[model samples]
Target chain A: MDLGSINPILLVASIMVSATPILLAAIGEMVVEKSGVLNLGVEGMMITGAVVGFAVAVNTGSPVLGFAAAALASAVLSLSFGVLTQVFLSNQVATGLGLTLVGLGLSALIGKPYEGMKSPTLPKLDIPLLGDLPVLGRMLFSHDIMVYLSLALVAAVWAFLKFTRAGLILRAVGESHDAAHALGYKVVRIRLMAIFFGGACAGLGGAYLSLVRVPQWTEGMTAGAGWIALAIVVFASWRAGRVLIGAYLFGGVTVLQLNLQAAGARVPVELLSTSPYLITILVLVLISARGIHGAPACLGRPFHASS
Target chain B: MIRLEKRPQPSQLWTVLTPVLAVLLTMLVGGIMFAFLGTDPLEAIRTIFWDPLFNPQFAGFTRPQLLVKAGPLILIAIGLSIGFRAGIWNIGAEGQYIMGAICGAGAGLAFYPADSVLIFPLMILCGALGGFAWAMIPALLKVRFGTNEILVSLMLVYVAENLLASVASNLLRNPEGMGFPGSRNFKQWPAAHNAELISGTGMHWGVAFAFIAVILAYVLMSRHIQGFNIRLTGEAPRAARFAGVNPARIVILCLGISGALAGMAGLFEVTGPAGQISIDFNSGYGFTAIIVAFLGRLHPVGILLAGLLMALTYIGGELAQLMLGVPGAAIQLFQGMLLFFLLATDVFTNFRLSLGRKEPA
Candidate 1:
């Protein structure tokens, strides 16, 4: 009931922190989708990244190495998906689901020994003069390395998709893979690369959850963040900037729900907790009703070369 | 250079043999994985695939336990296979299952201390309806707005899990049990209890329903118009449309049947083996059903066999954990491999793999 109890600065900071993982994952998935590939194993890849990141950091005493290990391990795992969908011409949807189940199970298996273990903390990057600013500085400037990197990644993707020839080729492949193949663009190869990039990004997001958010190894800790990130890609209409907005919006709901619980609001805690997912679905449905603008035409379709 | 040449028609032999091949590949690969984990590969595989059904020491209990474990999986998988066949992916059957359990348990709890002959049937109806309503969210959204059902349904599972936790803690908490977060044990409620119909055979109402579903589904797919339309839609959407088959009706029918079946599964589990509504009531039956459906080639009979096989793994997984200290997650990884290997080898059904220079376009 007390609006004054909530701090705007802290809320902004929390939103940034909360949104980082999804932003990273969605951004990567956006690239993959742009190349006309739909890899639904974000959850699996993220959880794999999470456990690997946590285990490496704890054992190596280096958070940076943990993040690297996460990216590498998840990317390696994603290659199987690439081989299945791209090379074997398996159904993309089924393969993605397999990736998720395998990733979850594999993460759980490997994470067993590391359960209850604490991870090395990732240091926040406090820019010299801006860190002292009352609101704007704390809201935007003060964050860990990954948050800033994620923001830069958004900009880089936007530019790449708009300007770079490689990005154009990716988009070309996504829009019409058969046409792209006719033009000698190597549709499968491009998609394979995009899938790997998505895997790495998903891994980083998982690493963020383990290294920064929870700072512990637990089974299913990434929860449904991977799915939410997938939804964000749709909600954003495959736009980079909109992805940032969507992630923050979703993150705000998550933070607001927890804030409601902390403030002892009259609403049931479970209802508040589910608000993020409900809102995502609502937004997704509303947008899709009107129809999407930039969805990859070949999204989720498996590519086979020989006719 | 290897090239895949599309066959004139999908090889029918591979269709039957692929599942068998996938199982063998999974066993070989999974055995190697177990070996890496320091367990004897053969012993691990034997324990997981063999011990539960034939081991003299465990058979007395494990034999009957297979049906108990397979009932929910078969029921849910059968439901999912219907939707998946029509390309209407309802990945959130887990959520529907949870809602069904909650709603069914809530319905039964409302008439607590006032037993009636009608209570059990009413619970079944409510449970199925509960799941139906829950599933309608994605169905309606997909129908009305063209939203993707996969993400929406799957996301709802987390929401349902939270709701489950909340309900178990607050609304359904057993009042007489000193503040425990569970409902009244329905096993003790004679009118509500889903007791085993056959002595020591684990033939509860759920198992019977699973069998009934298989028979009905088999009949429907082979002889019914709706079943033909379902298959037609999956194989050729444009042709189905050309034949005046209503896509919207198919979506609703598929999602509805799957949701209702999943709901019933949840209700049976809550009332029978589980015996109460608790926070941890869901043991991933919904998720596991997806694997079962795929493993069974989305066929009713295949799902029945796949469900039993999956259940065997579950029972054997427990045995592995007990005997060799193998982690539970490893067993899950092994089960997931079944689906991965299935899909991987499925390539041979439609195209033959050849090693040569890439075929000229």
Candidate 2:
């Protein structure tokens, strides 16, 4: 039994890549939840984005345009959710679930034609000095633009939540919508914006998968990545930095398991592959020990004017 | 005359009728969807809802499969309904189901070729305990740390899948079989086999247990003090607290029951219909059960019927896949449509759909 079989370098790099989608989606959902709405439709939104992004990229031959189209499509889909839950005051749990179902069906419908069609490859934007650096280059710099974007988005989101007035207001609403409402802030409008932002982010995450990761559209391709993103948000405890940590950790576990399987480890390939999910649950159990940090007070509750 | 009013309180009539109305509305919307997809709407509806049960051409084979399919669904849904009623969402039943099957199968296969009577009962216990233990993680987090059970439990499903895959390939691999990524055949092993009681009927003890679960659940929910406590917590938390109903206790109980039942369903499935453990052993039954629980309005009988109806679509949808050139995804989307449309139209049950005069904007 060669215990030293795990290649730590390539292992970490693959983990980062694997973690990218979950990170992107979790960050997006974090913003959404921070703005005082719980969208369980992340998986739906992500999958919808996955197929649509793949389709648009394949047709237009621009990965950038494909990502944009994906975000716009998902954002549009999420707008319907906003109208139903935010405007109509329906049950958030049920409506969000409904949105997922609808998104899934809609994606399947659209993706039928695009199935098996390879997406235009996203080029790795190598950083000059950084990407050229020996071992770390492959581990960090030599990756597609979406990978960098996910990292930047995390930083940008962190700063926005901490310093910006709009972020403050969003936080206020999440903490207590009634307080935000009394302070002359429009809760519904703020929430709607947040919902769209989250949806777009989730869409981008999905697009990253189809456009970059898997490079093809398949039915149910997101494969619960969206749900994992949702969990990462909770695991992150609603903080941007922690979200990065959680996502990467989950990704590392997933990639390591896959690598181990590829290395021809004596262990069953299935068990090794599933290690990430198990590790995610274990991490969630641990992170949940402290309760989630910065969780919005009014999260998952539909804010009614009369109530 | 006791007239139905939009009561200041929640309407009981609406509670009883919403699931039925949701089904009808789903049919209507699904019919439109079928038409949009270039299939005859009425025929699609018939195939989805009717053919599996009544059509002489298909019912012979399809009828028994309905119970086989519905058994796990009803089991999983019933467990989910309990947590839902308590506002403790366990969306990771799929993970729990996978774990149950893995653990149960693993336990049974541990004694391979040694035909002891203890194998079947031990598997059942392992299956239930496996699910119960898996469910306990989320429940414990929610109770002890104020963690979001929805997220924790859901993420765990993926973890459970990974475990199932690993076990199937490594520890549980059949020695004689040529490099297959699956466990030893439990059906052939009499002590572990969950075979049909009445031949060709497809009815197994699991189906019997599901019925028993419905009765047991109905009694617990309607007759017992704990049931009242669960309803109270779901309906009016403040009132429940005032009534001395322990919130933490209810969470534990609800999650435990749900997890155990989900596990039992998984155990039965692996032992009977599924035949062996593999990477694709779990069929999203836990997630679908969430839809089933809601579709059934969280009532036991409603869940039973809803389970059966959902099963019909599974069989019919498979038929459509074989007969028409319709992709498997289209059928999945068709199933998902039931939940989406049901939820969308459920708005009517709560809020009256009436055209309003324009407000002075």
Candidate 3:
């Protein structure tokens, strides 16, 4: 096989695009989990956002509105999860799975008519001088607005968690919910807000898929992206910057597998298709070696106001 | 001010009543969903919950199928309940099930066209081993590195599906057939087939195994030191450690046993009703077993009954598909409502739900 058959530069560029949704979703989930709540409904919220985003964009011919609608829909769904698990003190695992089922069903119903509809095209933002640079330009500067936004979000989240009062309060709640409750913080309210933000982020990620990547609505289209994002949260040790890195790494693996198949690699198509999942597991196993640093201490624990 | 008052001991009444309460709540919510779907809510509810077991036109077929469907679910759920009791969530039973089917089918096909008695036993062993080995990945990782087993196990499912496809399309493709992506029909293989032990009733070796699992699980949970340790670790980890229960060993053992049982269920299905391994060999039994485990209250007898109830929904869902043209997703939502309500109503287990009086400011 010719070495020239594959362009390394294009490979890197495409991998970044592929990783954008995961990065966005993971970053959002990182913040949510950091705020003393484990919202396992990312998959459900993402899919809902995907179809809602697609339908709105297709109807209004505005990608911005599509993204906004996706975030809003996902945020609303996330709020349901937050209210149930936080206020009613339902088991998070069961509620999360239910959310996924409901999301899949709801998306199918809403997306029924838009089954074959195409999405509005997102405008590409090419850096004037940087995009024209020989090799690095294709590797980094040339991408849709979402790619940059994902990276920017990572930085923003990193700063917020590291420096801000709100971030500190969120972390305090996550670390010791009882202590935070004793200290007079509105633990449930903060968590609900965090869950909403996480849902909105996941929605944006889902919208990116239907509105930009695939640019079409299909039933179950967000296909395990939510789960992958969850894994990324773990892989990143619940750190925002690490989540960005993990998302990109996963994205690279996905792109690499597809590219390998396209380039007629010796591996079977199914093996190539399964590579992304296998890689995610392997990466997670490796990251586990570093220990669960930055993991919120109080995740998944139901907060009862009284002892 | 109102507070969540602690009972001297958790109420046993709430324990038994939770599932019933959950079912009622699901019926109410699910009935509204059916109404939204434009079907007669009452008729839809009856079709889903009542008609499958009693309607003469359907009961004959559905009744026997219940045992067949419940067999794997009960077997898998029994294994998962062990892990759940030890506070380990083995969410990747689906992947383990697939691996077991693949490994078991692979073993049976390795001795293809042979009419020997050892083939079925060998298949069962390989299936369990395959599932166990696949499960060990997360268990070992969790023990060694303290990784989150939930994500690791669940993610492996996609990997296992790809492996199934690879094997079916290539290595396991029947030579006699013209390039079909599946193994030689297990039913046609006299020794490998898990044929019905009771004729026309659909009762097979798997159902027998499920019953045996329930008895063994009941004994283990009630009369064994390991069972006590598991319960202690789940309910009070610090106390369990102080009492000399090794947490690491428990995690590995719990995950290992669950994975093996899940794998066996997969193996049995592939050889018996499913007939062979195909790309779509899995029917999401692994995922559904979680619901069964919880619905059964993580008790062996409870799981047996819960498995049957869940199996009823599968049969009824199929009937709904045929009779009402309702999409399969609606059925998924219907089943999902059970768990949603189950978790929601579990609140009453620890807290009373009486309305609190508002004091004037």
Candidate 4:
């Protein structure tokens, strides 16, 4: 029952690390959705990135290369999904589920040799002036490069969607692919690019998990984080700024639950562990109940042009 | 350059041919994958696709095991196919399955040491109800609030897993087992055990129910107005709305049926084959059923055949692992490839390949 043992500083620092993966994934998925493509295979791409990232880091003794390899491998994997759903005009929901199956199975096969293996973890990058400060420095300034990169990514996505013409076209494509097609915009090409970007971002997030978060390779390690990211996208209403808030909110719940267990709180361990998922469902219900349905109209619809 | 032209209507020939084509394509590609893995591709392929039911050494035991494996898959997929037909996705059947097993097992355990004839039937009812209740969360939410059922249902899977872990360890733990986390074995409890009706045939109550479900689903989809409504809703929602189809009722019905079936599958597995409720009791039957539903083309008879084929792979994959040391994950990869090829080839059903540049209409 001793709640005082939980340090706010360590909690805040860990929240940044824990939130970074989902933040990266959610922001990327937001862009993809904005382009009117719903790629539900974030879990699949993330797991692929995790295994590739870990394998590369272990072999090369470099986390950066691991991250790059993860992004490349996941982006390549996502293109298969792109080809299937975009070109073949397959049902996006079913195809996305198939991608997850493929990714999970493929990652398991590729990760066999690396099971129970450790990888080179990203070192903390302490900002100069801020790192010297008291509580705020320890909480925010002292973190890995991925944490800051994830934040910058959110801001960058926000600006891109708000001010850029390309972003507007992407949005137009998402809102109504047929209308975008009538405007002579390459709807399929734009969607494919968005899907690729989403895959790469999901991969980087997964790489951060293996290379920095857990610092090891484990089968099925992503373990529904990708789904959580997808939920966060809905929770954010596809806005990049709110995506950051949603990821942090989820991350805070996760970290707090772990801290409670560590401190031997009276609450049952299972209850604490299940809180994040339940909270996500609660948040989704609340958001949807507000009647602010901001989803792209063309989301999850197959596009085929015949002129 | 190659181009695709939309057909006036979907081809009936391709509808039946695509699954066959997808299987062959998977075998070819999967063989190459096996070759890269250092196993003799032909041997691995034979072991996976042939040896389970044909090999003299394994057929006697594996034949019955096929029914045992396929029973839950077919039952769950039957329910899922109905929902999928109506375009209502209840991906959280896994959670419902878990809840069903827990509730069914818990109900049976409540009457421990009592040899009543009613125990097993009561358990089945409880199991279905548990699953139905679990599914109602997403169904109710989607109906009332316009929430995304996919995300909500998926999140519940994790929650269900945690609940399973908790109950297996604490609430349902066998008191006399001295520290092991599991329920009392149902096999030893005669009144509650879902035993095979015929010895050595693997024809348990679950298998019997699955067969019944297949026939019932076939009737419902082909000869019933509700089935017509479900199909109409998916094909043309605005048309369905104009025709006075109650979309909310359809959502509730689809989710409810799927959840209940998935739950019963879990209950049957726990009582018959699984023997006891444990932390790892689920074993992905709910998720794999999704693949079975798709591979069967969301049709009842198709799901029956698809379920059997999928079960053969499960048994054959085990045999392959034992005989050739092929990694267990290879079978999963194979199934995934099958789906991909099916989806890829599905284009032929709606479009024809044009070899030359498009002509003015």
Give the candidate number with the greatest DockQ.
Answer: 1
In the range A6-112, model 2's lDDT, one tens digit per residue, is 76777777787788888888998999999889999999999988888888899999999999999999999888788778866666776777677778878888898
Candidate 3 per-residue lDDT, tens place, B164-257, comes to 8888888888888799888788888889999999887779988999999999999988999888988899999999999999999999889999
TM-scores, all models, native as reference: 0.98, 0.90, 0.95, 0.99
* Docking quality class, candidate 2: acceptable
Predictions' DockQ, in order = 0.84, 0.46, 0.64, 0.80
Q: Residue B21 deviation, candidate 4, in Å?
A: 1.2
Error of 3 at B347 (Å): 0.6
For residues B1-361, could you state the per-residue lDDT of candidate 2 as single tens digits? Answer: 2211222455567677766776787778777877777888888777767887888987898899999999999999998998888788888899889888888888888888788878889999999999999999889888987777887787788778767777778789888779988888877888899999999888997898899999999999999999999999998999999999999999999999999999999999999999989779788788778888888888899899889888887888877666655556666776676676566555555554335553353
Indicate whether candidate 1 or candidate 2 has the larger DockQ: 1
Per-model C-alpha lDDT, please?
0.91, 0.84, 0.87, 0.92
Tens-digit lDDT track of model 4 for A1-307: 7899999999999998999998988898899888988888999999999999999999999999999999999999999999998898899898888889899999999999999887889889868999989899999999989899999999998999889999899999999999999999999999999999999999999999989998788889998999999999999988888999999999999999999999999999999999999999999999999985789998899899983
Q: Candidate 2: DockQ?
A: 0.46
Q: What tens-digit string does per-residue lDDT give for candidate 1 at B176-214? A: 979989999999999999999998888899999999999
How far out, in Å, is residue A39 in model 4? 0.9
Mind sharing the TM-score for model 1? 0.98
B1-361 in candidate 4: lDDT tens per residue?
7888889999989888888899899999999999999999999989988887888987888888989999999999999999999999888889999999999999999988799999999999999999999999999999999888899988999999999999999999998779799999999989999998998878899999999999999999999999999999998999999999999999999999999998899999999999999999898888889888988989899899999999988998899889899999998889888888988998899988989867786
Tell me the alpha-carbon RMSD of every candidate: 1.3, 3.8, 2.3, 1.1
Pairs of residues at least 3 apart in sequence or in different chains that clash in candidate 2 = A270-B165, A270-B166, A271-B165, A271-B166, A274-B162, A277-B159, A278-B159
Ten consecutive residues with minimal summed lDDT in candidate 1 chain A?
Answer: A298-307
> Model 2, residue B71: displacement in angstroms?
1.1
* Candidate 4 structure, TM-score to reference: 0.99
Clashing pairs in 3: none
